[model samples]
Target: MARLELKSVRKSFGSTAVIHGIDLVVEDGSFTVFVGPSGCGKSTLLRMIAGLEEVSSGEVHLDGIRCDHLLPSARGMAMVFQSYALYPHMNIHENLRFGLVCQKTPKAEIEPRIQRAAEILQISHLLDRKPSQLSGGQSQRVAIGRAIVKQPKAFLFDEPLSNLDAELRVKMRGEIVALHQRLKATMVYVTHDQVEAMTMADTIVVLRNGRIEQVGSPAELYARPVNQFVAGFLGSPQMNMLAGLGLQSSEDRFSVSADGGRLRLQLARRAEATTGDLRCTLGIRPEHLALSERGALRVTVTGREFLGSETIVSGTLQSGESIRASLRGAVEVALGESVAFEMDLDHLHVFDQDGAALDEVDNALPVDSRQDEVRQASPHHR
Candidate 1:
């Protein structure tokens, strides 16, 4: 395994700066994921680490050795690309052995390495099959197997499952995670999918506009985002954002009137950031809103999607702001009917006008505890 570090790493293409100064460390044997929207420089950062792209400034270190100046082949890392770059003419075994052969590995040693990799990946029976004869999943496994046979210090995956269908993507996610656990190797993965980053990473590095936004475990980022951008980006169905103006305050709580005074909220004051009447954004996730007749927020149901295990209801608040609620089980609500849903006070996220989180969470909510449990049970857990 290897410990990788980037010290004020930067990248620029002519006059356009793509990667800002980024200082990060990938702990030895940890699964680290770099995730963000497109053009966020995640792939560029990964390529820099792999020596496929040069750093404009700063240094890259591997196991305390400066490697930014080294060639990719000399960096002791294996990379699996989004497109499985297997040779069409080569069989599975030949593809797996290609790298070792190029390095002038002994003839006796190459066959043993190939055999071990194929067996571990459960592709021993398909070793004689050409790349064109295999399914997408099978081809991906061969690509990974090629990397595994190298036995490098660390592995790098650049959206390795992007080409698969939805169901296959889900299945391949589990397989790769299992592979990480079995090998216990250091890995750096780049993806635009937050779900993949949340599920697979021991540490998730969130980037925005070529700059680092937040770096933490999935649970930490989910339960306590540092800013509105991070909060809105990580969750599925996204958090519902409401423009509100603070009206009153107390020693440990405050009241905010949202939706042109149609919706009122009395939230616990976790920080001393907001004092007077200030305009801010109130964020509530879909799952945190429950259907209640006596709820404070009134909404008109616009649409409903019954997802078997849960129901996702889309509605418009009295202020004309669109909101969604994820209610448990099947909920039969008529369209255009006015419904009220209560927000889970403990799970609320408040952001300042500048999109910065204003709360320093003290009281732990049930959902937060559940996220903690998930983090603890994760195979990537430290």
Candidate 2:
């Protein structure tokens, strides 16, 4: 296990910078995931830590030692790429033992290491099979087993399951989780998939154009996002955004009006922030909305999807802005029919015109994270 820290780390290609000055810390034996949209620098940041990319500035420290100047091998790290980078001519046993052989590990110790890794990955029976003969899932396991024989200080994975089918991806997710519990190894994974990050990470780092949007546990981010971007990025169905005007009500309550429909909101802590006719945006998740007789908003259904246990309805709100509702059971509703939906105030989120959350979180987060300074995004970085 190892602790990894990045202090104002940066990277650039000539005059164009891909990764801005960023700082972070990954605790020993923790699984940290880097998630964002394409060209958001998640993969580039991971490659920097793996020593595949040189640092233009700042420092990378591992276990209290400055390691940015060291080679990947000397840094005691193992990387598993998205593609199964296995040697086709080599059988499973050779693939597992290749790293040990490269390090000139004693012949006596190589066999036992290979045996243990093969057993741990449940690939012992496939030792005699070549890469060409194995399935996608099996080939990926061999690649992971190759990394395990090195006994690296940390494991770095770059979208390691993106090529597999949906079913195999789910199965691999469980295997990786079990492997982490059994070994307690430090891990850093890079992916654009939100579902994988939500399901597998102990901590998720949301990035955008080389800057971190937010960092928190899966539950923490889901319940309390600092801004509209973070809220809209993490959820599966995504949060619905609606424009409205807020008026301060007496007794620490507030009211919102959109298209002549009024809804009372209770906000006790931030009464000062809600004074006057404030223009703000209201956000709500699909599951937090339900059909009701006296609902505040009415929608004309445009689409209905039955997702096994849950039914999702997509329609335009009273204001014509689109919104989705995840109601209980399978809902059978005809297209263009009007349906009333009641918003759960407990799950409702309010954002200012600038997309900052109206609710003030009193927790002590990092200084760099609290300040959202960003550079002009280039067209190439999309």
For every model shown, what is its TM-score relative to the native structure? 0.93, 0.90
- Please list the Cα RMSD from the true structure of every candidate, rounded to 1 decimal place: 7.5, 9.4
Task: State the displacement of the C-alpha of residue 309, model 2, in Å, after optimal TM-score superposition.
Answer: 0.5
lDDT of 2 at 193: 92
lDDT of model number 2: 0.83
Q: Write the per-residue lDDT of candidate 1 for residues 94-115, one digit (tens) a residue.
A: 8988899897888899989999
Output the lDDT of residue 50, model 1: 96
Worst 10 residues of 1 by lDDT: 373-382
Q: Clashes per prediction?
A: 0, 0
Q: Could you give candidate 2's per-residue lDDT for residues 226-298 as a string of tens digits? A: 8899899989798988886775555455666553344444454363667777788878899998776556567
Give per-residue lDDT, candidate 2, residue 206: 93
Candidate 1 has an lDDT of 0.87
Pairs that collide, model 2: none
Model 2 TM-score? 0.90
Candidate 1 regions off by >4 Å? 250-252, 361-382
Q: Distance from true position, residue 203, model 1, in Å?
A: 1.2
Angstrom error of the Cα, residue 72, model 2: value is 1.0
